[model samples]
Target: MSRIVVIGGTGYAGSHIAREAVSRGHEVTVISRQAPDAPLDGAQYVQGSVLDLDALGDVFDGADAVVSALSPRGDMENEVIGALRGLIKRLAGTPSRLGVVGGAGGSLVAPGGPRLFDQGFPEEYKHEAQVGIDSLELLQQTDDLEWFFIHPAEVFGPWVEGERTGRYRDGGDVLVRDADGNSTISGADFAIAVVDEIEQPKHRNDRFAVGY
Candidate 1:
């Protein structure tokens, strides 16, 4: 089993990824400021923030792969980017692969087109979502790490835990929509997609989207 470290592993997306990874028999380490209530079986928990590079650096030791599920809110004047920059630098010249859980705001609706955040997204979440978009932008510019950013569809969160059909439509630089002309997926399905990306390295140095 591969040793996987998930930064921000206590959040909505991170916790799901941790659970899915453990179910796959992979050794998982979760790094976050707080631990989850019902932690996944067969997984290690480390308390730390992604903004703290030094503290976060220790968790990466001997790790085969790392996943960033860090979502920074507020003014975007934080160290989320700084922490990722450090991760890229530390992973440089190493064999560690990176998988990022990006927000839907960064996912495009068309080829080489504007992101959903740029279009008619929610007003309340516009700022934070844009920050997420910017974070993906930073990840895109990082040539140091072998990484792929996975963006989920519009309807993803704790409310919906999709059934494990292991069936999902993947697309690059374009949104995947259902027959009703809506782009969406459950959090569980998105978790499956994230783990699939970890097992099969696709869309390296680029972003991809998933939907039901």
Candidate 2:
């Protein structure tokens, strides 16, 4: 089983992913500003801040893969991409694979042009949402790094907990939409997709979007 490190594992999306990874028998370690309210069965929770470079590296030690589910929020919140800059540097020369969670707005809607956020996305989400977009850009420019970026469709969060039918559509660059022209997915299904990538690596050094 892989020893996976999940940053921001206490967040809504991160928690779901941590749960799925543990259910699959992987040794999962969750690093968050605070431990999850109820830790997953097979996972270890570490209460820490991602902005602490040395402490973050300790979490990555001996890790087979690293998944970043970090998002910026509130007044004192650390900048998502900024914090990752240090973490990525610390992971250099390691055999670990990296996967980062991105937002729908960050997913490309066109080639070398507009992102999903540019297409009339709400201003309220621009701050935290743009962090994901910038993080994806940062990952793309770092050609030397081994990383995978996963973007969830328009529908994401605790409310959309659908069953794990083990089926979903994958898209490159653009967001995937359903018949109703709405691209969305339950967080549970999103977690399934994340763990699936852990077990079977795909879209390395590239970004992928998933939806119903």
Candidate 3:
């Protein structure tokens, strides 16, 4: 089994990812400043902050992949980018892959055209969306790093936590939407996509979108 570590494993997205990886029999380690309300049975949880990656000690050692499910909100609104920069540096020459879970704000509404963010995104979410956009740009500039960024559907969040259908589609840099213009995916299915990529990666040094 691959050893996987999630930086914000106590959060909504990170927790789902940790659960999925562990269910798949992967050795999973979760690191977060806060403890999970209900920890997964098969996952290892560690208290740590992504802002201080250096102080995390050997938490990432021998990991097959490290996913940053951290969000730029609350006290962390201004810290995600800086922490990501440090993370990239640490995994720069290593064999472990770095995967970032970003918002759909950066995804193109249409190929070679306007981004979802530029199309008048909600004011309240603008800041967090901008951080995701910036994170994508940061990864793109890292030529020597083995990294991949994933943008979830526009309606993804804990409030809309749907069931796992064991199905999802990759939009490859473009936002995914159905016929009625609904763009969404269940948290569990999204986690499935994440772990599937971890096991057999396809979007190396690239960004992709996942949706129903």
The model with the greatest TM-score is 3
* Clash tally, candidates in order: 0, 0, 0
Q: lDDT of each model, Cα atoms only?
A: 0.80, 0.83, 0.92
Better of 1 and 2 by lDDT: 2
Estimate, for each residue in 102-205, the C-alpha lDDT of model 1 and write its tens digit: 77787877888887887889998776576667777877787767888888878777776666677789988677888897877876678888888888877778
Q: Which scores better on TM-score, 1 or 3?
A: 3
- Each model's TM-score? 0.91, 0.93, 0.98
Could you list the CA RMSD of all candidates, in the order they appear? 2.0, 1.8, 0.8
Candidate 3: residue 188 lDDT (0-100): 93
For model 2, how does the per-residue alpha-carbon lDDT over 147-204 read when each residue is reduced to its tens digit? Answer: 9999898878777766667677888777888878887787788889998888888888
Residue pairs with colliding backbones in model 3 are: none
